[model samples]
Target: MAAAFLSRPVYPGLALVPQARRHIFALEGAGAGALTDLAPDAGALTRSDILYLPRDPDGAAQAVALAALGAASLWQAPDLAALLSRLAGLLDGARMGTRLYAAGSEGFIGQVLVVAEAAGIDPLSVATEHRGNRARRVQCVHCKTVAEEVTTQPCACPGCGLTLFVRDHYSRRLGAFQGVCIDAEEPGSAPAAEEAFR
Candidate 1:
């Protein structure tokens, strides 16, 4: 099961990608396996600005912080904090009327909401659900050489051969929910169900 959400103010369309090196640089001395190899699709995330955050250790913190700095708008791949800090930062800087799209784990969404509230930024809305389909095996964020199955436990990257962990999983449902594009047949369609069932 997965969840997604669409934010208000409808941001200008711009591609946004995370930069692995920048995140690893930020986590210098924090650990050896700081960066993770992004998926090929993730790597091809062009036509948009990219900002990388570590996928191991406490990568969520940095991801959230970077997301909060989004000037065009904020969109996350369904991890914890949903990059709320980046969204907030964008809002704080100017009243550009940006939109936010977040997807990933439910816990991550909650964390983002909490942080947003604390920062005095109100999300347009939220939706919660489970990730759809099976999780894919991906390269270790730290080493960027080895491929491994997705797991909650920590493992080492095969390339650089550094220890790594599944910091956060991406979610499409969260993005749909934030974007208010979730389908009625979707698992987290209870809100829509109410229209008929109630």
Candidate 2:
């Protein structure tokens, strides 16, 4: 069992909510594969709308595969912002009995949960599956700056210039992991950053 950090998210992977009348998928990068892997039935596919954002160039292929699923609609967002914007719009007009699924890196899923919350949806109710890129979004405790795609343990704060030690702790409201100064006890003694969450 994963450690039950009060705020840390635990992904249970994507499963079809059979009773749902409609389905919405917010997918990022290789995360699109999760849906394809599910092989939703024809009835589910006909009622599904997908919002996909490629994490990198390779994401184009995943987008293509998701398109072939024959979903009711598949939108390839140019960026995360575009995906979120479209998601917000869809949520605003969402009818009852709609189920949401999100998949991707931790950072990507965090942002998706934030959007879901803004739409008055319970973030916990959304199905999630962690996919490519374990890189995290870190927020500096001292400076309150959130950095995207942080892959190291001791990372430099882009906002306050602090050498922050990223922690496993996560914040659902902020959609980021906690980062604290690593050299606070002994200034300039922080260890060199090494890849930890690629």
Q: By lDDT, who's the top model here? A: 2
The segments of candidate 2 whose C-alpha lies over 4 angstroms from its true place after superposition are: none
Residues 1-198 of candidate 1: C-alpha lDDT, one tens digit per residue:
122322212322122233322111111111112122222233332212322324555556655654444322224334323345454554355332332233323333334444445556464332222222223233443334424233323433446544344333432323211111122245333231111100
Residue range with the least summed lDDT across 10 consecutive positions in model 1: 23-32
Task: Give the per-residue Cα lDDT of candidate 1 at 177.
Answer: 16
Report, for every candidate in turn, its global Cα lDDT versus the true structure.
0.32, 0.93
Candidate 2 similarity to native, TM-score: 0.96
lDDT, residue 115, candidate 1: 48
How would you encode candidate 2's per-residue C-alpha lDDT over 4-45 as one tens digit per residue? 777788999999998899999999988998999999999999
Q: Estimate each model's TM-score.
A: 0.27, 0.96
